[model samples]
Target: MPDRAPQPVDRQLPTDEARDLISLVRDIAQREIAPKAAEEEDAGRFPREVFTLLSESGLLGLPYDSEYGGGDQPYEVYLQVLEELAAARLTVGLGVSVHSLACHALANYGTKEQQAEHLPDMLGGGLLGAYCLSEPASGSDAASLRTKAVRGDGGSWALTGTKAWITHGGIADFCTVLARTGGEGARGITAFLVPGDAEGLSAAAPEKKMGMKGSPTAQVHFDGVRISDDRRIGEEGQGFAIALSALDSGRLGIAACAVGVAQAALDEAVAYATGREQFGRPIADFQGLRFMLADMATRIEAGRALYLTAARLRDAQRPFARQAAMAKLFCTDTAMQVTIDAVQVLGGYGYTADFPVERYMREAKVLQIVEGTNQIQRMVIARHLAGPESR
Candidate 1:
């Protein structure tokens, strides 16, 4: 049967404008994103045109300033839009998040001239982006990244290093790269906006993964990639801080995406349970199955609420790093569980790719690892609660 009409989300939007924005997003997601999600994912094809469409429709830069071509939506509203897109397809939603993350350094920390020069196109100009911070040797310990950017003749910088597990690595139009510029450790890192077609910049083959194949994760190599001094973002040694600041917000994006996946899985399970026959009645009649659905729905709602709470705190200009970490941790773990249970509810069909639940399960696994591992998230939360670990 046709998939239940894009499971309704009774979002508690604060304004009619926000509600209307969400409605627009849902309409686009249901019509454009959801229909091709399964087919595109199976083909391992990144939908570049779809991203262009999102750019044209102005869904790409929702949480930034409208003067710079963003949608000027609040984080709560922006994240709800992300949830809708992710429910339709994880690649698209996560792609938007990474693009926004790439834009963050320039948007929040760039000089006024830099903003005037680059912000508009990056936001709504249909130029895809990638955030480059994780090195092959430093995934969880991001501060230990060793990609080096050295000063060169004539006020230029020469960057040479490899960035691993970068989403949209090969296809991005621009990358917000972080590289060591001073002495060792986090204090030495600096951010730069690197053009994708720079002479020495190239991406290795995409990683062969369990899921989300449509979204490329590859190693981007900067072999003496030339960047003008003007491309530098913030101070010479502020990249790590800028990267962490962006991630604090980016984690909420992941949380929203996780909730979206969980909600989709729950909807599929509910639909299957109600329709599938078990002996004399539908399987939804079984108490055990019913309770599973209840728990799934409850977790989905809780995750959504948690992310929104953090988003509101950010909108209010409050310190929300700890809350964002909690949402990321809780929501990703919930997605993993919910999708696995979704597979169980559908019996054999769920285990196979015949249904999308298996894909959802595989996709959920990466969410736990990306942005920051759930283990790292715990460390962040603990530090917030009881100060940093005593060196």
Candidate 2:
């Protein structure tokens, strides 16, 4: 049987414009992304043209300022669009998220001159971006990153360090880099906007992964990369704060992506169970399979709701860090569970590359470990509720 297209999600958009935006995204995803996702992913080919199309379609900057070539949509609206794209393909969806995170510091903290000079092209000029925070020695403990930036003559700075697990590392047009400039620990770090082709910058070979192979993840090295002082974002010693703020928002994007993956898995499971027969009847007709389907649907709904709630909090300019952590933790766990169940629903066929469920299962594992691990998310939640751990 031919593969079934995923059923449309009944999103609770706040405006007609938001609803229309979701419709446009879904149309693009089904037409442009979903069709080639499996083939290109299997070939380990990055779909650069697809991102260019997204840029031209005004989908790349949905949550930023319209004056700077953004769509001026609220986070609630922006995240639903992410969910739709992710449901079609996680590579495209997560790539967009990382690009947005790369733009966050400059958009929110850069001088007006910097915004005027850079924001338009970065937002809509078909340029890709990468966020550089995690270093070779630092992952969960991002505050301990050791990348260094030293002030030089003529009002410039020289950077030298390696950023690990960077998405779009080698292919990005630009990067938002955090480097230490003062005393030890978080307060000493500062943020800079570095062009990808900076003289001393290069990327290591992409890491071979169990899934999301089409999206390049590699270590980016900065060997005495020099930039003018104008490139520094925010005040000195503010990069850690900036990085944390961006991650609070980035976590929401991950949550939305997780829900999207789970929803896709559930759809696949439902489609397969209803068609594959056992005991001379569709497997979906059995009570056990029916209960499993119901539970899968429920989990998807709950994950969606949790992320949307966090998004709404963000839109309202309220404190959402804790909620964002909760959503990321729950939604990714939901994705992992749903995708595994999807494989079970498909039985033997699911085990083979002939079906997509096995791929989905592999892809779902990484979600639990990215942005922030589920363990880190729990720690963040605990700190918010019970205060920080005793030193």
Candidate 3:
């Protein structure tokens, strides 16, 4: 059977404008993104044009400053948009999240001159971005990254490093990169806005993955890529703090995406159950399948609430890191379980390439591992609850 279009979720949006925004997103998702998702994903084709469309539609900069070509929406509204996009396609949702992350350092910490110079183009000028912090040796221990940026004549900086698992690596129009400028740890790092086509910058072939093949993940190599000091964001020693700030919000994005995937899977399962009959009645008529569907719906609802709570706190400019970590942890784990149960609900059909649940299952696995692993999220939460772990 053909996959059904996911039903529109009833959301508690903040305003009429937010409701209209969501309606528009659902229309776009159904019309533009969902139809080609399976085919393009199977072919490992990245939807660069879709991102272009998003930029043109002002969807790319929804949570940024209106003065600099952004939509100026709050995180509460912005994350719902993410959930809708993710329900259509994880690649698009996560790509937007990463692009927003790439823009965070400059948006929050750049001088007025810097913001006026670059923010407009970055926020809405059809330019896609990548965040560069993870290195070959540093994933969870981001502060220990070893990418080097050394000062040169004429106040230029030459960056040399390999950044691993960078989404949109080769295709990005710009990258927000963190590299060492002083000593060996977090305090030595600095952020720079590097043009993707810079002289010595290059990306390796994309990684082969279990799912979301439509999204490229590659290693970015900066072989003495030179940029003027004007490209620097924040103080020389403030990059780590900036990166952490971005992650707190980025975690909320992941949580929203997780809920979206789970919602999609549950929708698929329920649709299938209602349509597919067994023993002269629909399987959904059976108590066992009904219970599973109910549980899946419940979990998805809980995940959505958790992420939204975190987003609200962030929108209010309150301390939300602990809640963000908890949201990422709970929502992603829920996605993993919901997708698994969704597959079980579909029985043998779920295991096949013919269905999207199998793909969703694979995609959900990575959410637990990315942004920060769920294990790392637990460590973060523990530190918040008690004191920092003893050395």
Candidate 4:
């Protein structure tokens, strides 16, 4: 399909200001992000300057308190912004989500002094951040993470172990890490804020992925990386809780991104069908192709609504974990199906690198696995309904 402007999404905004914010984001996305997306992803280049611009525009911390550098926008509004950015480029949108996840620990649980000291820089000081919770041996079973942090004689601690599948691993300015502070199991883990340039901290090469090549995914090693006691976030045993809380919100971000991808694919399919002719007429005139496009658009709309509902629940300060997981599961599955259908609509051209639909398909696959797999999401939802599984 030929490149075209983003299709308009009718949104329910809480205020005129929110609508204005979306317009600004769309302008930035069109002018700065969408055009270079394919080229940068092909070259496996992360657009650091784009992030700097986002920081400068106050787009990096949309959902946090404005007392810091956050935009103080609600999740409902913030997620729509994410959708706009992701429609332009997943690397940028997903990167913002991960950065918000990294800041969650300190922003929510850190002392006031810590917040005043660190939150501003993270929100808009142009510093990127990463979250470290998963180890090679403990991806889904995060409680079993083996990374250790031993208390020193004074008020410092030294961490040692490897965290896997870290987004922006090599490029982050700081990391919010979960490590063992006591005995085995979840209760022993603690969260810490460690500078990227900490002694003995290093990142291995980025993983060779099928898509999202522009965003690096790699293993980060903490070899006796030391941090002051002041860097500790929340209680010693509260790290797992903090991690789960962050993921609850992070899942909504993924859902928004999934919708963005699906929307882009649908737009491409519609554009291609309306232009590409067969049997002496545009394929869009055929009922079979028209129905496919209709279904694609319908699914995208439902997925967008589903995610927005979850985001709204979160903004209301209510119990939203079940809804968040539901959104993550439903929206990501919709993206996968919709993108695949988009490929079918384009026939042969869709399967090749010549189009972005193929890339959207590859990128959609990962959303099902991250922030708790679809299986895990079902488990979470089931637990919410039927209570925890009996041992």
Candidate 5:
């Protein structure tokens, strides 16, 4: 095969339409989200009213097809909306990202009947969703999950196991649950659309997470929960692939959220430097502080570019797992670094909840862990390079 021409650098600069989304996001984030962020985060409360507002504004389904009640916007536009939301409140931004992840199984792998039954509630209303894949025994090695779903009388299956670290575990109306059906390893896995209110299904008390507090995380326990065979997404052995695919898209959302947090950190750093005077002059007037701000801005720009490039590949129906991993790893790490520097720039003030930079710093740390940790991302990238023999 001949070598292909190098693909053009995927850019993510705002278009006319993207600008309109940005304007709308800014207005809602400022007028609605920002004011409530502290109250909700402190109380570990989910922002139901804010989510209702997002649904009403058509911001919840920005990347899905318009025929499905989505905003019909491109991933680039959707990501910017997430970034703006993250800049205002990490809780809501992550909640949106998790909902999109939950929607992925139905959107990409669901049969016509499943999509018709599920997509509208997920893509149109204020309803939230949870993607249930991780379990107590499985995290990075998801193929090793032991959640079992044995066929029962008639055409039903009884699912039994615990799904750990589920976002929106208790609050979501629905979940895309992955469970084993046939044998060991990934091929035995199957994805099931389990209702939150299903019999024998219960959510544990929320975990006391270190950050992104308002976004509820808990363990979902299924003790012989019955689901119809029709609820299975794709074939019986396709759950692993579907879960991976959903995480691939979910990673891009996390990357966008990271960019938003980093952007917020950069803005806060600039504002503080310009306001806090030292040596009879604003700190921002110093070349040292100015260089740091420049670096933070540059990092955010590069992270944005990588995520958009990967998202374009996804939108165009191209192979993008490696690219998605790259974006998630780079952008999340950049968010951590930039937020740390933002705190450093403020000295003592940045360490307190009195300033938003401290909250942003705490929030950025989790981006590195969720939607496949950065370490897992590097493994995915390396496997792509190590050839077919590696896996």
Candidate 6:
């Protein structure tokens, strides 16, 4: 469970800029974040100071535009930075991913006026952000979210309903919320930027989860919270589209995190195999164990390639929803497999907290569940394949 040094890999070629950013992130991960990961996870603590360090280092805004005080870094570079963070601590890395998801609506759909008002504080502030799309009755059925945003006096809107399973719900400064604005179904929805402190807005106590203990999850409630019309992202009926778009990008983040988790698990297994004596020789020297390591490495490499390809397509402004789903499905499943195999390699020790593989195994399960479950990803891919007439 001790923090491991970043091992140099020959295949991980990086441009000068990427090299500099990776070096900076890896240093921070080892020197600051990794040391605190175990204690924080055990206490179910959120790392506010770590987020502040990331913001000050400009890591929070890695893939955003510089015009709004962001880093303007490429997706390729941003993803590598995320991988380093996730490898050190999954909670911190996922916090960054959710924060980025919350900011995407503003960056992509907000008008100049709205962006001017919020993006600077959103990207530069110490407080994190949350994406409020799921409801008690809806998780994968996002378009069926029952939260309502009724038009109010003076061009404002009154929001009322609960957003369930919100990441950083209690800790966030702001939320990108989706609510029903018209009739039923997708066209009835609208995306709104609601301040966390706005009247009638509150979060339930954090949920006790199986893993990612350091990341707080809660239910967000909006009881007639009034927000100005200007806070609406895009037009009425655009909420579904906006939410889907944000999720496509969010899936890439999840995929990158999965790769990191797998990589961490694989690295641990490799080290243990080499050091642990089996019968008379090192376990790593056995052909059977060596083949398992080979498979784990191949799977991790494939996951990395898949996510990077999806990210490149996104950055190029191309249609990438299918690609995103593909990456998420592949990477998460790979993480699940690699983490399980990592435990097997360690025999009895892997199942115990004495080793990190057990924790990684638990953590990897949620990756398959969140950001749209693997089943949902398959549905998405099928729809893309069957064309518009399929639906």
* Candidate 1 wrong stretches, greater than 4 Å: 1-5
Evaluate model 5: give its TM-score: 0.94
Global lDDT scores for all candidate models: 0.93, 0.92, 0.93, 0.92, 0.86, 0.89
Candidate 6 global TM-score = 0.97
lDDT string for model 3 (1-391, tens) is: 3344557999999999999899988988988888888888889999999998999999999999999999989999999999999988888888898999899989999999999999899899999999999999999999999999999999999999999999998999999999999998889999999998999999999999998899999999999999999999999988999999999999999999999889989999998899999999999999999999999999899999999999999988999999999999999999999999999999999999898999899999999998999999999999999989888
* 284-345 per-residue lDDT for model 6 (tens digits): 99999999999999999999999988888877889989999999999999999999999999
What pairs collide in candidate 6? Answer: none
Clashing pairs in 5: none
* CA lDDT for candidate 1: 0.93
Candidate 2 at residue 259, lDDT? 88
Better of 1 and 6 by lDDT: 1
Per-candidate count of clashing residue pairs (backbone under 3 Å): 0, 0, 0, 0, 0, 0
Q: Write the per-residue lDDT of candidate 1 for residues 1-391, one digit (tens) a residue.
A: 2233367798889899888888888888888878888888998999898899999988888998888988888899999998988998999999999999999999999998998899999999999999999989999989899999999999899999999999999999999999999998899999999998999999999999999999999999999999899999999999999999999999999999999999999999998999999898999999999999999999998999999999999999999999999999999999999999999999999988788999999999999999999999999999999998998
Model 2 vs. true fold: TM: 0.99
Residue 370 error, candidate 3, Å: 0.9
Per-residue CA lDDT of model 5 for 155-274, tens digit only, reads 899999999999998888899999999898989999999988999999999999878888889999999999999998899999999998888889999999999888878877887899
Candidate 2 lDDT, 106-170, residue by residue in tens: 99999999999999999999999999999878999999999999999998999999999999999
Q: Write the per-residue lDDT of candidate 4 for residues 4-105, one digit (tens) a residue.
A: 456778999999989999999999899899888888898999999999999999999999999999999999999999999888888998999999999999
**Runs of candidate 2 exceeding 4 Å displacement:** 1-4
lDDT of 4 at 227: 92
